[model samples]
Target: MAAAAHDPAGAYDLLVIGGGINGTGIARDAAGRGLRVLLCERGDLAEFTSSSSTKLIHGGLRYLEYYEFRLVREALAERERLLRLAPHIIWPLRFVLPHDEGLRPAWMLRVGLFLYDHLARLRTLPGSRMVRLRTSPVGAPLQARLTRGFLYSDCWVEDSRLVVLNAMDAQARGAEIRTRTGVEAARRQGEGWIATLRDGASGRSETVRATAVVNAAGPWVSETLGGTLGIDSRAAVRLIKGSHIVVPRLYEGEQAYILQQPDTRIIFAIPYERDFTLIGTTDVPYEAEPGPVAISPEETRYLCDCINRSFARRIGPEDVVWSYSGVRPLYDDAAANASAVTRDYVLDVAEADGTRPALSVFGGKITTYRRLAEHAIEKLKPYFPGLAPAWTGDAPLPGGAMPGADFDAFLAALRREAPFLPDETARRLARAYGTNAREILRGARSLADLGEAFDGGLTGAEVDYLVRHEWARTPDDILWRRSKLGLRTGPDSAARLAAHLTRGRAEAA
Candidate 1:
């Protein structure tokens, strides 16, 4: 079993550095194409910027003001595609863009919505339409003066879960996913490149060789290029910090709000975890190190102020329960304003006539990761001649293949099958594991059969499944990425699971 879990040959066709969305997406695509791929991440998947997003799968409506029609169109199309591909984690959302008479004019807002509606022909979701706040339920929580607004369709995603699902699919297709393994350095060796990987936990090093390499290290892209590969890359990335705050339930609706700030930037207040309203996203110029970013007091105030301007209820920094920050490694386009910088991605390939190719990816949002992977693999087609055609667009991600891709129907069936479990517990499992929920519940007829129970719905059986199937070594991997129960559980919840996991690992070893 151990031998089958790793690459015995110690070599691969592609060595992908970084386990974020793009790297995992590329590894999944390449492995599906019959390429032997190895992906190594210095930390847990989506532990950084990939998990710290606005959690929307929409075409940037604000980007239209900057005339980024191409990006908008592509993203809008991808949004619809993802809704079908991963119905378990991606769902349609209605965003209310309140007409702030002080800022963008009513006529201008109408025109932008018109363009946004017509950009890509939406099939699963409804188009945009103007609404009167006086009668609309969406405006019940807003100020009286905000009497007019426009409602449009977008999608919400389980951001970190999306990354893990891609990695799981990649591993299922014969790709090696090594978490907590950092690639210290790599150099050209004849027709391929050799890399040195250091295990974070064991403090051990091993050498790996691959025919090609992909650097999708997010914020560490430039640093990885210069420090590890010894190549001075021309590709520049602008580090812009984005932060979000989670507060108590702001309103009583499932719909989200897109607040237009006085600075012309936008903030989203979405229904999160059924108990909290997630508000956020301040775009600030960042110049510090990338990892371990946290929302500053100023950023919290800024976000609170943005919300206060739109909603009737007032909130201060004290209202914030939890906050997170991430530095977006955007491709430098020389834009004066940090918010004006392009979110588009750039793929740079370094290779001579006979040298091995090292592909570096920079600056992309979550919505277009799959398309970016397709493009990246196509660029390296000359080296991988036997690669398969793109197959991820129509294919369902792991555990997403519900009947007709209908999540509600699948949830109903899951509840009926697991009558012993609570409705909320069944729903959580269905949402997180989808069709794979049965695998975790196998041979368990009752709650006691599932073994020990944590404070929340988490159980010993689920933890064992995560460690055995997913590359979950630490409790954070299960709490934060695989699930967001970290937000609701106690601060010591992860620590409390430590002894259980340690015992389990020792018994298995």
Candidate 2:
């Protein structure tokens, strides 16, 4: 571990390592609370586990079976809060759960959905309703044999953009945000922490001093603490890998499907990007390094089989258009099965000799990141007596503060302004960039003025905006993280983007 360098002035109030949802959430909250904060990520914002989520701001209805009522209720409440805060990015999504006799009984699911609806007094989203699948459009994609089902509500989010919006909000609130910067080491000084950060692209190092350090590295939490800070953290992080497959839209309606497998785990088939269906999530113990998590053949087969079993149309491995994997840094609870492990997060604050302190976050889900940030900062309130009070419950993230936070109205306004742009492009920009869509279209009057088209609905203007504002560095960062253009563009488009990025890099140099 590196020793603390001598500094005459006091160090920063907090230094957060990692640009994932949790890290950015913490940075935003801390900065909002009048604390001097600095956040650093070794790669692009949400370039790893954060962007690879199922993209639902859900309460995890299945967790009720494991008696995680508190976790479920908290997340359920947050779903509504996020909808109010970022209506452009997070909106209500109804889910259809088709009853299968072989998997779970209908009565049990009814009770689960009942508890889910009432657990948190939902305001904007409607309550759960029993459905006759034979008469409903949600049943069209399923086998004719399925006659009964239930409909419930959750929220969908642009997962990667959520992280970027959080980081942008933090930066707007006086927090120093650094992407492609790795925390080399951190050590306890007399009353603060001295840390070394290295630029990943250029290999340049800069020393920083901070009053406290938060290890919110998501999957890299344990490794960061033990390796970078030399702190023997008591909390253990269980690495469970989850994978998702995207295919052309198989269903017609806006509703998603929650299919119950024989193993008792539920697989989600969500309508994604207008023309694609997103199916996901196999829980397997993972020991691989934290970046570029790849979907294994076993996972691909498992998801395909699960989807095929529920729907009339059979899907196979070859039908998969795109796939992604992410390791959930779950808090270790000694669960025998990886699927049974808890998704709840735990915060451990270590203070040696009643002076220097280091806070380590164990596990968290995308749905509960905002609440987790508030709780994490609450844990450190005593250390910083002058820190402001908690206040992230109702705050708007960047690009989310449009009139009434109403997405439909915002879209109507944008369409009137940019009538020449395709309706699809206008809606996409409004949803992804919110009020900033004007900035992206700055001087463009026609499609030609927007510059080259790299992929479906992707253009040079959007790419430049991402590179300049969203911390997008490489082509993959833009295609995969900033947007899902990779799915629409295919392998060749990546090469074209690479060439464009290379030229931009050379011109800048």
Candidate 3:
């Protein structure tokens, strides 16, 4: 088993940089394949681009315009696989695309939806069907001008929790996961690669050696490769910033809306946190540091305008309760428009003289991250000739072993066991922790045993579970990654949590 403390001089079969979905997925896959793996992250898992996605596990419907047939098909297939494998956290969702003659012609939209439905052999989700806007509940929130729309199936995911779950599974499978540990430098050493990492909190530096290295740092991929390892590859990553705004729920149902903007770009207004609407996404080219990616005033206004144009209710800045931004590290395909950049990922393996190999991932989406990991490990198969064959397709992620993978039934069971807990709390715990919800609420007969209530449904026991098992080091991990309590919890709650964390760390030291 890999040690908890970083041993700079220790050797590893693989050292994966980045703790996002792609990186954590690769580490989990590689470790399961019998490779000694060590994954290092400069920040918390999914703190960057991975957590900021539109939080859909859908096959990119717009990719059809770019003629990315294969990519779309593979992503569509993965959607079903993920829904089955992690039903507790990922489930089916319906999207209503209101007709807009100015953006996309009705015939063209029909063709796209048709192709989307038929692209993958969908067995579980319902196919696309035209709805009468005047009659359907999905159309109630829309303007009266829109008479008809199409409702299609997709899957919604708890994006950040997905990353943490991957890391947890990887750790359970014997892979070491380190958060807030930055790889400061790396270089070729003998027939292997040696790297130095520093803990962000303590500034403690350690050296380690690895037979192979994977650069899956998302937006920092290029910088980590060239600056840390001194290897320059021809493949480049294009950074496109996308933003999302959360406002009070505008509709009562679970159905989401995919609105068509006049500029030919599509924006999604989805149900979030049960009481909020998540409207997002602009595709502007970005060139800033990956951290501190915040939604801009212009982007907020743009999203609000799109929503107001489609729905009868008009929302403004004051209505935006929360906002976030993330950069998509797309493969630089030399496309003139950022929206046209390819969502497909590219793997670059630098093995000069066939001695030391350093693999770097270019671009990938959350929906296709599992496939990306499988492909990445396949690339390293030549080095580890005895590695296990791909198996994640049939494997269930941690906490996803509900019978038939039926989330509703699992929630019913949880509510029966914890009758004293609020219905919402029981459902949230079951969804977030699956069968492990019992472990979190162990020995607790009532809500008071769960300890201090922070925000949303988060409790002290849940926070402690995240810190002990999920590699969560800071309060933000609990607020943002494990749960979106940051939006519901006031700033004062955050400060109190921070103080508690500081005290806990001091006592542990």
Candidate 4:
């Protein structure tokens, strides 16, 4: 287990303002570069926008139409790197895009796929090819009209877990990670920043000093700059709300469908949680506070309709098992359409004459977070002249150092080591914790030894491990972010887990 000491006594080299994907990624990268880093998040790691992604790491095929060649090439290259870096959470996935002659012609899509395949030259993923929907399993659930389609490759990621693992690696590298600690304000103190951090639970505040500050607040980017730091930022971020609805399994195959809508936009219907189909992502303009965002009725209906258009098995709003919405903080490119907005990120560094530097991140995608972090640190190299060179591209994340980087082989080894765990339970634990699963199953020899069971497969041992190592306090943190067992666990599961954690804390005290 990784233990972190909370002592913000001396001046630090860097203070990261957000705890989302970009913030955590930068924190991890900066710490690996030998910087004295302190990171503070108002909520749990990946509590908001970072946790609400479509959960795929791929080069944006659609962005090619907008002439975003640079973004597409970099994202495609990063996709391969991330696949190697975290094989446990990120794995290859085949995407089937059914032919839509009216929307985009067959030859046009072929050309796009050709560009996509060749853009990232050094790749092991199979190139795209034409497929007959009638004969292939991918076309089994699709409408009969969709006869010919194309198949390409991308990768699926455990999005929230990726964020937590980055934060974990950052903490393990000597970076201070404080969850539920919000930075209320910041001001120039001498040649550094004096930031006021407040603990939400205890209503306690502390003042810490850092030579530089990083503003990576996703949706709250502008707010953090103007409201918290009283800094004028030239760049602006557009908040576009993208919502997804999860319904009962629509098809039997493991492949995902990328359906093109009539509006020139696309929606994805991917396999989710083994029991459901994850369909999503409508780009609707949003203007509201970023916190507590939910899926609107119209957006939910839009998603259902989009899936209905592609799948032979029709579904209505009533078929939805779960729904979630998140606002994408895309850099405002003055585009009239929300879907056309650039997914690329912009780093704005402010360094007035003789003043401390503050870098604000504008927009980025989950697929390019590592690259984004590397870029952020590279931009600040002048301030920290002795900072180490970049090393995250080749380093394996926590628990990702499996033998041969093969998850299946590692999982088999895990089952062999712990023969008492059920097949399904062992698989789930291995996928979630990777090699660290042994740490949770250390002394347990039988099912009963795992401790109290919460309605579903959740056990007391797993909960304690989450609290002690992953900083998971509430039931939501365990059920939603750390794992998605909330869908299977009973209604009383949260209360039970809450009681257990409360009692455990009291006992520890």
Candidate 5:
């Protein structure tokens, strides 16, 4: 897929310049509305900020402290909507917030939880309630000093899968999704916008015309506008780095712990990947060029200290098996610190005398991506008069549709149909693909029918499906993003698999 300079026949109604959650979400919405859409990403979808979330679909309980009632309310409302839309990847989770003496007062927290519970209608999740940590099994892992805790309801998400499902749905609805392609520049051309898109592999540039452009480039939102589009907007983005670490499972059970730090910040210790504890999220200001960032020594220490203090079993940097960091391009509202920056999104539509529209999105969390998409489409509605009404709220994302959106029942049915499949394999496939898993294993009689078996239950059929449909090219795309099978892969197996996939792709070409 080499880029061509002149392709008059390839004109589009909208050119979305990012494949992260917001960009993919917008493309999905626009395409569902019958817009001719093209989305280009310099890397794989959700390769950066979109994938590097706390992986929660929740009303930010901490935002209440900042008086972001509108954001919290909107997110709370969207929580159930997303759960309905993508039940396969989004599930309700209970967070235990222990009331420590030196941190936020117990009554203040009670009031905040009260407000959080009443902010919106929660149909699938439970309301917050105080728990006697002294007697409850949920508190057995925590330090004895944390005798009092409050259990609140939120949702956990497969963050990267959310992005992929959106892009996949967009493509199914007739949107052109180009991964490993970058938009080099865009300019207002007469009544619309013309952009130069470059193929990341071949380094060839192509010219494309679109009715409008959406700059949802995540950490590169500002750079895409000023550096690439040569348009200065009234809005700007502040870079903030958020980091997380995955360690050997520290505690038992499915519940997660939200520990308040000494600096008035909070960190989450969640059960991850069946056998790991995921801890994270430091709000350190970043002042460098944006790319894949790593957890710093100081951040590692900070997170470890937070965990060590809260849990009975102490952990140090030595316990960390994997750590990742991503830079958040927050809307610069002049907050005093990185942690205080608003997670609400701002859509700035820069136009040439109100003719050619270029909308740049800044500062949004994953929890509110669908709403942000509706607003983004609304911002560009002036150019496309025949644009359809918003319908994503009621739409099911790819592989999310099942009777009543009940995952447990669906899993049981899958097990019945594929009785030869191991319990873990069946559960993983059902969780990952929902009804679509059937397409991969359709008529398969046994594990051998799935072709070569890889580490962590990954199969040749699954890899081929990802490469063919999900735009997965490299091993990281399959192992890390499309699935977390990498955690179980040995270096030799991974290198061998990478070479095999590369050769397979080349041979297919």
Candidate 6:
């Protein structure tokens, strides 16, 4: 459950700021290892960076250029572990990277693929292969000149849900996940740190204490360190704004494309939501204040043109139906190019005394979050002599505890059990909730039992479930983050949902 800004037992062992993938992952891992943990987020979980990813859980194919072998190897090893942990929200996706004539040579591409394939023991995802783009259906959408391509395996994740699932698991393990709350200031008092948490909803500040503080604040790492914690991290962040655009499904089929740009950068054109194609992620140096960002006209045009070079069907900024942007807080290694900044994480520790420790997380991608969490906890081992050994690798996150981690088999059985549900609705619920989907549909014999219908299969029952279990408050939390129904559902349905939630709250009051 999402806890209120009230902690009756007083002090905690760990106080985690930022509710992104890294923060929640650390919270889940630390709490499971028997720590009194309290995770406070300034907004809803993944309201920024974590939610705004290309949503690929892969050893970044392009990172090979930068010689990020260790990062790639660690990420490559984690794919199957995460796939097993949350099969509902994560699944294998095949990417077709076509040879663009003047770009990297075929042999170089093969070498990179070979390294990616053997980087780690890939137990679940298949290895890479060369494909004939001219004859295959995957080629139909591409330009004819792109005759040869490399087909490789990666996993796609519901990024926001992954954050939420981690927060949920953390909560289940006795970690207090307090959302819409920010640690205004923290100071080391005696042997521990005393923190003032400001709740956004109530405009109230409460005093809390923790033996250690973990700053996983993604974009606000520096700001949080200097402004809130009054500690100089000495580590800097390179803010690279990444933007994506969604349009009508560009091509038919489940396969996605990784288009190469003349600038040596790459963009992905993936199938998104059922009816739309997701394209994007431009790496631009961000100079402005770091908060919510939008896709600039240049970025939109850049994305369209990148994919246009390969795809036969052309697209433009006007074709964009939805666009989102997030700024990556990469640890600055001072690379000349914005895209060349490392995706690896750097941990800066500040502990004047042995008891009160402040650890700030710098840069990391989603695929390595679990490993990052394990390592973060291990870093604090000196502070907590009794900290339990790491265990997230083999464990399952909440609803993903289905036998064998076989999503297809579990989905088929769900269809048989809930015969009355629409095929699309059933599949959506199964993907979102996994085995726990049945509980939401339990006691309801027919579609009518789902309560008032909203767009994109959202029902009153699901809304109540989200409010009760998922820490959802505003419409945007449910519409955009908890579910992407906002893509298809119009304003009318959103208004109705707003009213329903308001009325429900009033009755409870």
Task: Point out the higher-scoring one by TM-score: 3 or 4.
Answer: 4
The CA lDDT at 319 in model 2 is: 93
lDDT of each prediction vs. the true structure?
A: 0.90, 0.88, 0.89, 0.91, 0.91, 0.91
lDDT for model 6: 0.91
In model 3, which residue pairs have backbone atoms overlapping below 3 Å?
A: 8-207, 8-208
Model with the higher lDDT, candidate 1 or 6:
6
Q: Tens-digit lDDT track for model 4 on 1-509?
A: 34455444756789998889999999999999999899999999999899999999999999999999999999999999999889889999899999976989999999999999999968889889999999988899988899999999999999999999999899999898989999999988788899998999899998889989999999999999999988997799999998899999998988999999999999999999889999989899999888868998899889989988988999999999898888889999999999999999999998767568999999999999999999999999999988899999999989899877899999989989989888888888887888888889989988788888886578999999998889898889999999999889877777888899999888877
The sequence of per-residue lDDT tens digits that candidate 5 reaches over residues 123-178 is 66889999999899999999999899899999999999999999988888888899
**lDDT per residue, candidate 6, 414-506, as tens digits?**
999889989999999999999879878888888899899999889999998888888888899999999899997888999999998898778
Measured over all alpha carbons after superposition, the RMSD of each candidate to the real structure, in angstroms, is 1.4, 3.1, 1.6, 1.2, 1.9, 1.3
Residues 1-509, candidate 1: write the lDDT tens digits.
Answer: 13225456588989999999999999999999988899999999888999999899989999998999988998999999999989989999999999998899999989998898898876568988999998989999999989999999999999988998999999889888888999999998877889999999899999989999999999999998888887777889989999999999999989999999888799999999888999979999989877888988999999999998879999999999888888899999999999899999999998856568989998989999999999999998889877789999998999999878899999998888889998888989888888988999998889998888876699889988888887787788888788888876775666778878899889988
Instruction: Indicate whether candidate 1 or candidate 2 has the larger TM-score.
Output: 1
- Could you give me the TM-score of model 4 versus the true structure? 0.98
Q: Which pairs clash in model 4?
A: none
Residue 233 local lDDT, model 5: 78
TM-score of 6: 0.98
Model 1, 191: alpha-carbon shift in Å?
0.8
Error of 3 at 67 (Å): 0.4
Model 3 accuracy (lDDT, Cα): 0.89
